[model samples]
Target chain A: MKKLDNTLIIGIGNNTRQDDGLGWCFLDALVKNGFNEEKLLYKYQLMVEDTDLIAKYKTVFFVDANKTALNEGFLIEKLTPSKKVSFSTHAVPPNQILNLCETIYHKKPTAYLIKIEGYEWDFKIELSKKASENLKNAIKAFIKEF
Target chain B: MNPRKIIIEPVTRVEGHGKVTIKLDENGKVSDAYLHIVEFRGFEKFIQGHPYWEAPVLVQRLCGICPVSHHLAAAKAIDQLVGIDPENLSPTATKLRRLLHYGQVFQSHALHFFYLASPDLLFGINAPAEKRNIVAVASENMELAKKGILMRKFGQEIIKALAGKKIHGILAVPGGVHKTFTKEERAYFLDGIKIPNIDTMIDWSKEIIDFMKNYHLENAQWIDNFAAYPSNHLSLVDKETGALELYNGRLRSVDFEGNELLNIEDIEYRYHFKEAVKPWSYLKFPYMTKYGSANGWNRVGPLARLNTCKYITTPLAEIERRIFKSTTQNKPNNMTMHTHWARLIEMLHCAELMKELLLDNELMATTDLVRKGTPRTKGIGIIEAPRGTLIHEYHTDDKGLITKCNLIVSTTHNNEAMNRGVRVVANEILSEKPEITEPMLNQIEIAIRAYDPCLSCATHALGEMPLIVQLKDYQGNLIDEKIR
Candidate 1:
């Protein structure tokens, strides 16, 4: 894997929730591909403290499972801070973290979101076959694009 | 004149999914109201087959906001299962656990005030929905928002250092904590070099309390009276001195006017408490069995803690607590909105407690982290979580597998109190009104939010809960629906 300095990759989702594990699985794939383990973070959800974390990095990539269908099994798009705000300590959206970072720390890291389509959200840990395929495509596209 | 019901589904700015239903009589007068928890997670049943040693880690899956509370509570119970009571634990181990618990409470209270409840307080309930959020709070008051973020971070950092991660991190094992605090970890919080130090946290906590006091003074009419009602209050108080105790203590309950109802050993909770289920919601109403279902229910959170404890041990918080009590002439403050004030005082108390622990050299002990004695088949652990009193009880068979598990989470205890609050607000704001407006709906939510109810633990689910309101006729036909 190519070495990327000063870049933080945050994989946000719960691995116990079947396809919701896509984000963490993506991070696992990166580690398997020889990416620096320190650069990757696995999170069940984003929180206010994440703003402090992203401030030190020059770039950040948020990867999570998307419930909605995307044309490509996966999509990677540049991200902008969300003006709309909603909060539940159980989970906070990635874009909102970026917005908080810009608001508090006055630093806007170059950010992008890699959303992999998912299915079968249940209590089980195993991803559905279709979601697994989408995760593979997402990892492949993510590595090439970055 | 047709009777109607107004439903507010998925209250905004709360932890999990809950809905409010206000039933109006044919005369357009409020007849009944309820706060319903929708999702259900059978954690108690799922935890039955797990080993006794795994209880601490397994229970954390119940909540993200207060996982540390769950983790510590389960750890205490696991400690008893291994035959070590709280008093028998090594002093170093005990202080380390206390520090971790205080850190958990500190961060959680900061999150609740700065992120969740601050919006409703900063911008009045009548303010537009878009403006009632942390982002909007940040846009308007950047320094305040930054302080909120840093204050929360300080607490998370403490968790990370003691445990391994911020959420669901492992700290305690069966008999005692798995690890000990180090000088570097202690310095990180005390030295104030990297992040704001303990002193700074204490200072900022004081500043917030002042802000709350001033806010109360300006909005006294609403702050003291909104959704206010008299009921029983419950929490853990210091076993010996009767001072405010969060980590471990004897159970205490007092009525609305400051009458002692029950004060007993924490482990003997089952003998006094009973849970009653309602068909309308997944959450159960917990009350003292003696008082019966209707009158037995008690509110168990910051407001309850202040109401039950004789005095705060910390000097600064004691001062603030006195001022808070004076508002009601030192009687139990039944004001629902004053919960935010009590929560801030607790945050300050936690800050003072953290400083005392960090400065103490006992945290440096590396040995004697675990201890055990004669084993027990059943163990109960209760602690003051940020939201309220959290109880975890487990029974294991000879094979060491859990045979039964019961959890009376903080939100569960306050279920009835929240319903009463909703009814109070609905009656005040919506009774006799022909139309249901957004502000009207928000006022009902404000009542529930005052308790800082963690519906995730109440109903136990993980998902997004968007705000939706539906109006129905008395016969249960949907007349109108609106989603935000």
Candidate 2:
């Protein structure tokens, strides 16, 4: 019933792992850019808990890392409610989270999954060289679009 | 009859990477079954050189699902390193940490029982793999799925409000915590975040319990002898009050008969509990000293905590526990499948506890948030992780640089029991004809899923977990596979 009109941008990834934190890097960029209209959230992974917040939003973007094979740099894909949600407490796909918002919360916030490419996701915090460059390109694109 | 093998690799629904392998003998009878944990995170070996205070924050990165557990356990261990007495935790700091733990437990348990475990319990273990998930639940029963998501959001909101983030919030420190609970936070919980949904938040848990109770016969059997094995149980219990303690308490071990085996000091977990590694798994097997490795292994998590505690400190959960225990005739209930119910009850306890903690007037004490003290070289912090008992031990130098660190996570504690459960289910459910139906394969996983092991989903990426059940020939070649 109440709308925040705030486009909820959730950056999801393991920040401690190299390149995996690329999504977090985007959230950092969003904050540093001083773009205040949208609510910025950082989560390690998407969960069932996120749907309520997503329900209040007018639109949502889930920024995450993709293995190189999935996307070489970054790909923004439209999301549909996924009927298949695996039995897990920690992980739910962004589409499924959107589905929960539409199904449970009675609100359908237009949703998109922004997949960033990553080379090394080892137990390190800093992004690898290729991932860093890709992040920069993705940031430039985000700035232009937003 | 040629012996056939059914392998459920990269099992979906649980955390981290683990698989189930069921072997059928020449007579087509169940010969051997094993649940294997394939990944190895050498946190113990790698966290050695970091500063002692960094242990809590560093280990939180281990699991996105239960970072709060690792965070609190590491903080408590570091608290010991800084010489905070178990009996003398700063009142304000203790209460704040308890509130934080409540949020963690609430969110985690809500997520597990409703979203993960209930998918099978409600849908049936024999249900088609493609049709047995929350999406199906949402489509068929939108109300239940809605309640589950919102309830989970409530728990997560509390976590985000206190810890500053949902996944890994660095709020705790050695002597005490980093922040205090402010009015803004209370208002956030009471009005701001949960304004319109308070009624749903409070009422839905009761309805869920009542709904689940409707299927007593079938669900009880689901949790009965097959997956629920009798073994020693371990959890944190108040030394004096004998109540179930999640945040801080003395370690207690009980037999399957609910007899107290040992009342161990938290500092003595290393001396009493021993972990042994097998060649097959990266996870270690933990067993009590008295029973020895061959038999001393015990179950933890909701079932263990529920069975071992004398009384719960909270309200609604306490009532639920009474009914639960009465079902077992007030003795130690060993049914592993009932862990789902126990988790739900604990979650309700957390909600009630949060209501009490948030409304109380005198909960904040920024003055005592951090204590100034000389650091000790070694400290062991223990807490009942939502899954089970989480022990974080760090050895440091006088300068507080970590020399060695050993972590005993929740799932590893149940490793032996999970493997044993697979065998029990295979023995009972698997036929001599090696039928290997989807339900039979599902039953094998049902045994392991009761544990809700954190081993698989620990890495926690956006990677899709397609439910795949693979049937392999004994020669290690894939015979057939079904991806749901």
Candidate 3:
């Protein structure tokens, strides 16, 4: 296992969609724990598919809630692109994003995904109890990994 | 004589989903023409129960292309509802907002001129499908195309810096923006001002102006009579005092004859304005009932803003206006075909405003992000969105939970105008040609698309929408139909 000095952690989820904000919550926790700004790259939404950034970074951590698969708590797993995830609202998907980085820059960053199980995907601000707990666990695990 | 059918499906390279239909009679004459919007996502309905503070974030999701405009309007609305004074917001915060807006103007106008509308100019309307794109234009005019790309990128970078992300920024809150512009950020912004390639942009704009002068002058007759109606025009005016108020001011209503009706405040909006839903489209039409019979289903946005304002404040835009007026009747409504021209003028104005706001020393003094006051029982925020006039009306409980919310987007104002424009084109083109073809229909669609209606913003959201198109003959028979 390689421990990187500099890391870019991105939280990808809709904050209004309850558990979709899991990625952002993890990012908030890291900031609260006195994580230095230089070691983190916290983002709420993946608006543009800037492939260059992905290729340049050493380690990339993406935190989002998995709505399709129900895991009620934090599920820490290393995610590789299986085809392209069309679940994103953007033009480029996660798989294509990785592929673009590799093909264009000949570099692949070590990537891990932290998915918290979400119960509510509807338009709401407050998170479910299970999702909130999952988020807390995910943050702990993420800190441990760092 | 056998009639040929022309199909230009998916109208590629545009921002949103839309289609064009044209029918010609046997004698190669146009029989019917229409511009049809295929997708409809109701954003208004989704926002009904959301908190007032969250309105900015929710509405920003309306359009990926111009999310900043929605964000600005929503922020303005919140400010209005809460009656937060401009002085309360740090002048720096306001300046940052203005800068972001100018950045929006730069990128959006560039997208329209370079990618969407340029094809019609660079390649003639009759250009082959493969040859009519920015990529094709880049192959020949690489430097020119690169300038547009750079300009757009610069604008996006400004937004990305001020707000955490580009598309939907959380920085813009109810009272004011959450963050302030640091010295480093200001230096980075000033560094952007040093780019020498901006000269290329000026030259490109001049070329576009020349094209508008020549080609658009000839085609102006088509848009002249289409959707010509009288209505009041409303926008944010500085009012001698430099205070910013989008929701509290009097709504300026300008007539077809360029006369001011009454500049009533937001509370009086119901007395003068009422929204009517048409069966043809999901967009709601806001009409001035005070004008006796609602004859004026007027437009909002670029063209409407230009028409409403007495004089543009910016020097560069004023110069452009002089040149624009030299070619026209000097009346704002006369140059309907010059909506593209109006967009560029507003872009200049927004830029000038941004520069002035950034230089204001008072902007750095404000520290209060949210006003320390009770939430209003009821409030309305009205601002001129990039598309046009946007209104966010809300009713909140004592606990700050939202009870009801109503958003009347800019696209809704143009709803009636679009329908009227389409009917005019359809009546003229369809009646002349007997055979219906795709190219002929596309021209009519182009007319409607010139408005750039964001129906998603207008309607709010329910679910993913499938495309739908319906054609009716003179005898009222269903001639052609497609729904997916």
Candidate 4:
């Protein structure tokens, strides 16, 4: 945020959960396409303390894979701070993390949830071919928007 | 009048999903209350047919919160496959594993205390939910929050340096580790412990303990007395000197009065323990062998460890340990809520242990990192995780592929206690009212949180849970319901 812009592109998911790794793959494709920036980071999952890290950015694009999102390609939705607060560390959503950012940091960054359709969630590391193709299209569409 | 039931599903503030069920009798007095922990667990059965050596790294996938514990425990169990004499671990290999373990415990303890449990104690459980999270923690005390983040990161740095990655590290192998502690890494941590101005991880942990014991928890303990009940405690201790032993030790069980009940070998755990499966939950209930099911259910984890140990070895943690052992200065600290204090003491001990290992001359030795030997069938490994004693038992064939495996994690060990805690809290709080309140339910969850149950090990339930909770009359008809 301090470098070129206040925007952050973060990919969040487990890399080993087949298409769940779409977040990492999407970021990797962005990097390969020469759309690299210091603001881009990848996390295994959204965490409770991530609010502090998110507060620094003025805008954020959170990329993840959703099995139930639109099957066409990808869906992008604007995010607002939600009042949800989790006592458990495992089930926190990105919007709630932003809500925490708003509550604690007193700054509300513009954020969006970028969800790519995924079919498989097996125990291996490689992405399925269909998932790979969808990732490509999703990245192509997302970059165009950016 | 029909009976009513109140249920809280996915008991928040822990590592995984759980549920608490409270049944009200016709008179509106609390009749039954128990906690059910759920998770997806088949790795033990699924790991069969894989090479014995693969168990160490494979089981690490079970819980992201405690991968290092699994990694080391599996590695140690496989060590027996090669038949390295117990006390004869190659000096170099032993030193490296111990350092890696200390790093694991330090980071994990820091994460649980600063991230998970602190909010409840720092801000009251009844505090506004938005103000009771890490964000608020960061806002209120910027330095403490920042220190927690950095110190937790420092522990992960050690893990990355040794295991290659912070989470699913593929470092520990049977008999030893793959890498040696390099001098450069040691210097980096040594500096991390003390730099910028004059600050150290040890001192930070001490300050946390002091603050918690003296002010934060001291004022709040009155509200969380459900955590202060008596129960049997279990932990691993040095067989000779009876000190708190993390990486390896004999299993010890003590009563509420701190008198030893029994000390057994890890290999003999199967004979001394029994696991029962309740029809309602995915998690199994584990109890001791001699006492039978009625009297055998006991508790493990930080509180148990502190209660079972004769003394802590590190000077800073030892000072805290004496205070923790008996808040009254003469009895075992039975308050489950005080596990937060016990965790900080352990973190302090781990930091001191990490410094001692980092400065040791033999830590950087490149040779003897692994031992070469033939594999044998049936190997057992036991180690103390950040939570409690973790047991990994494997039986293999002549071909070295696993045929059977079983794991008894700390959460499973404390399942009964968690349920009992929920019941105890409900009994203490509930009255003739037919309806239950949200704060009352949250207090029940606080009971389960006291153990920090790791449901990843217990979860084998398929698909996502609809998390439906129903209230029924004594005849079991759906009279009321809540879905979450």
Candidate 5:
């Protein structure tokens, strides 16, 4: 068992929405692999108050289901603060959250966004076959690096 | 030449998907305008056949922003199905429910003001689209943004503590609540160790109201006149004292001149009100049947509540209410943008009410959490949600299954009012202008945002629904289009 101390991982998406549950599945894989449960946070979407949670940690990872095509099953890229104005509060993008964290609390944590390629997004709990494969690969990649 | 129509789809910064349609006659004069709610979730229709008790939990699928409101409203109705009236509920249960309701109101007001309305107030309507959002507000005024966030967080914490989660948590069950407030849970808000104390919430609430006052002073012309119109006002007031009451009270309505229109028992709303549907929107127009469709529509929410109430029960809020009333010379304030001002005053009121409940010792009572009475087949629950009066009615069968359900949410009550506002703003801003800029389109959104309508509770997929303004002629051909 490895201790990922001083780190926070947020899985953002709804489990009920088929492949959108990829983020939660990734975190679930980490838990099964003996990762600490306290370090992981689950959310349906990002909100303004999330800045407070991310500000306390030294490093943060945001796991979400991606709609766009990807070279690999998953990709992990560093996230920087973005000033992109969101039209609605329905979905606050990860970059804007980072920006809010820096602007509001003045704490800049090292952040990475792990976007898993999701093929299906309908009203079902189980992931699609391809999405499941991507989740597994994403979990393996996440574990290999961390 | 054919008449022209301009559409602004999915207006920004509000909760859900909505659009504004402004029609121009052949002469380029504004003929009509409407704020259409495009997203549809047949929640009331689908809620049928579930166990009557499940209404509270299932109805929470309404909106993430104000699920607690729906949860409680349904619970109040379910209590009737279980044969318990509101008065018969235990003191502890009533207190717990009131606290949760106040928390919902407080957080919702804070969110609306800070995230949605403040951008327009802070940067003015003429500011660039990018500069009129939460990120820009935070960048420019860090302290105000921080306070807004924390004030909202405090109310959410209260909801989380009582309901189990902030968004979809459940506290009330059939006759009463399932749990009581604990001393440990209470201290988290009172001790000022982990989060800002309730007193801090009170102070911040007052500060924001003051900020609104100053903003109003500086921008009185627009703040006072923009989309301003005379309309009826509706809310729930204390049955006995006629003071501002959110949790449980008589349904009160007043005309624009402060004349009492209707004050009825909450359960008798069906007799007085009717919902009329429009061809353009899924949202229904709710109005007093007596006043007919045209004039019966009453504006609900902070401004309406202030107008209909005799006074506020809380000391601090009563004082602020007096000042708010004085601005309009004790008349029903018809200034639409003053909704922000009224909403801030309500944030202060909710904070004060939460503090009063947090200190009361009865809140810790573990006994009498649930109550049961003579069972009934029909129940109606009405509460003043942060936005306005919310009604939930249920009809049950022998097996206690919901046979039918109807909801007249706050936003539905304000549908006609919002359409009127859009017409007002569009006529003023876009009637004769040859070129419509993004900021000009924003003025229409500014009017609708004042009501803070929760347009849809639909799914928020990982994409932005950009504001699309399309100019189309009477033949339905796109003449011009703009996107932001």
Candidate 6:
């Protein structure tokens, strides 16, 4: 398989939900902290399921807050698996999107899952302090990898 | 005799989700009528803590129908707060902005006039829901309906050329517009004009006036006693000449008799106007008083503007003033139906204004588009949106990050008026009938819809469940519960 060239940093969450916006928050911090806009590619909300957008990138970094069965402020790291997680309402899952890319373009991009632990997803304005702190830490870690 | 309950659910062919409910009392009297909004997108809350620069783009998303109006108002507000004289923008850029705005006003009004309200006026109220649409009207009056569509397309094209995107163009910024109109763009805009159609539209408007004169005479009676409130009318007046300004002007509020309320300098808005949240809806009602709930039925848009302006500037607008004046009863306030006439007059004004700006030689001068500034200050931007007065107030930190943002959209200003109008129509229709038919209720709904209330822009209440109205007799027995 041909290796991917560009890195896609996908931030996924409903912005209306306060702490659920951690993934976007971390991405925004990265953008603010002198991250080159050219190298960093693709930002999406809720789900990165746009077919056209998914097909172009070689590497996909899915950044989202994991609310179910995860420690608060913990990072869950994983590589793209053959079997994709099933979620209703999404156009296509992450693995399926990658597979489609490979089938069509004769190349598959490396994928990384960076899920931040979130405490509250209630309808509120301000972010929880713990989630906010975890977001800063996640950004720091992501930058180290860069 | 049992009075029938009529429910117009998910009022179609409009911008937002709203419903009209008419309730009949035991005496068969129309006890209550309501034009209620179901869904609420909290734009005010969403915009908080973002950059002040994103105000235009974010606020524009509030309504797909009137994105240009929101864009212009947001840009004007930021320009005021940044203390940049947007009048310094090349006249061509200013004209382009005006042209785009005119397009928004024309298309939006045309949508209301042709698609929404004209169905009831042209066809009887009892017409089938499926047939009561612009398509039905177009089938009978194809050329006339096509004219409106053509006019709307012209406006959209102008917006697309200037703003890059016709709907939510981010061209208007703090100092001035980002894009300039090339000679080719200007020629292309002028190329599509149907010159003969202008005469046709003028004739069609005259026919509309005649129709309203014959049939809507009683409709005009409801607003006969309407009194022009002497409160301040706020608008963006040109800073240089103090003439009626559209795009880049300082916020000025004048009374009905033409008295200045306040200059509303960028920093002084917090002192003049305060935003109050209502428990009934998510939309924040803005009041002129420094403290307390928003009181009194203050108005915005064309009616308030006409009352405030000393005289109409454009020739077509001046001619159209007769249509506004022709319907007046004892005083100026009686002709609420004149809002329709007033809207057309403004459309003419907007078009003429665009032409004037384009012809000016000074418009071609390109100086500074973006002023280099690092000063962070909280400021308010106010402009006369097409529907009414729109205010966008922002509190920003020293880094220009938005701490809090409040938008008093056009529909919010007309909320009280719309409710009052609904009540008046209900009272008039319900008093005479022992049994109300679905058609009668539809007429009442049409009366309220004539205002063209932007429910999306208005305050959002909790989601509307199926309305259940129960009527009880004096004996405490369950009389009836109408479920719709």
* Residue clash pairs of candidate 5: none
DockQ-better candidate, 3 vs 6: 3
Fnat scores for every prediction: 0.84, 0.84, 0.00, 0.25, 0.69, 0.00
Interface RMSD for candidate number 2? 2.4
lDDT of 5 by residue, B218-317 (tens): 9889899999999999999999999999989999999999999999998999999998887888888888999999889999999999999999988988
Judging by DockQ, tell me the better candidate of 2 and 3: 2
The structural similarity of chain B in model 3 to the true chain B, as TM-score, is 0.82
The residue-by-residue lDDT of candidate 2 on B323-408, one tens digit each, is 98998899998877777778777877777778888877657656767774655788888999888998888899877789988888
DockQ for every model comes to 0.67, 0.56, 0.08, 0.30, 0.65, 0.02
* Per-residue lDDT over B247-364 for candidate 6, one digit per residue giving the tens place of the 0 to 100 score: 5555565544455665555335567666655454444556667324434335566666665454566676766565565554212332345555566666666666656654554444
Q: Between prediction 1 and prediction 5, which has the larger lDDT?
A: 1
TM-score for each candidate, following the candidate numbering: 0.94, 0.89, 0.71, 0.87, 0.96, 0.66
Q: In terms of lDDT, which candidate is strongest?
A: 1
Best by TM-score: 5
Candidate 3 wrongly placed segments (more than 4 Å) = A1-146, B1-50, B80-90, B193-234, B240-250, B292-294, B366-370, B373-375, B461-484
- Tens-digit lDDT track for model 1 on B258-360? 9999999999999999999999999989999999998999999999999999999999999999999999899999999999999999999999999999999
CA displacement after TM-score superposition, residue A14 of candidate 1 (Å): 3.8
Sorted on TM-score, best first, the list reads 5, 1, 2, 4, 3, 6
Report the error of model 3 at residue B467, Å: 8.8
Q: In candidate 3 chain B, where is summed lDDT lowest over 10 consecutive residues?
A: B241-250
Candidate 4 lDDT tens digits, B85-156: 346567878877888888888888877777767777778767764565666776777677667766677677
Model 3 Cα lDDT, one tens digit per residue, B1-484: 3333333344444455545555545565555444444567766566766667788887788777778877876676676557665446545566667777777766677666665566665675557545555555555665545555555655676688778767777667777778776666655655545442333444555555565666556766644554443444555544453122222244665666667765666555667777776454455667877764356466777777776665676676677767766654665564344677777666556555655655655545546545534456666666666677777766766666567777777777776666556566666655545554444455555556667666556654312323334555544466566543
TM-score of 1: 0.94
The candidate scoring highest on DockQ is: 1
* Clash statistics: count for each candidate: 0, 10, 26, 10, 0, 5
Error of 3 at B312 (Å): 1.6
Candidate 1, lDDT over the whole model: 0.91
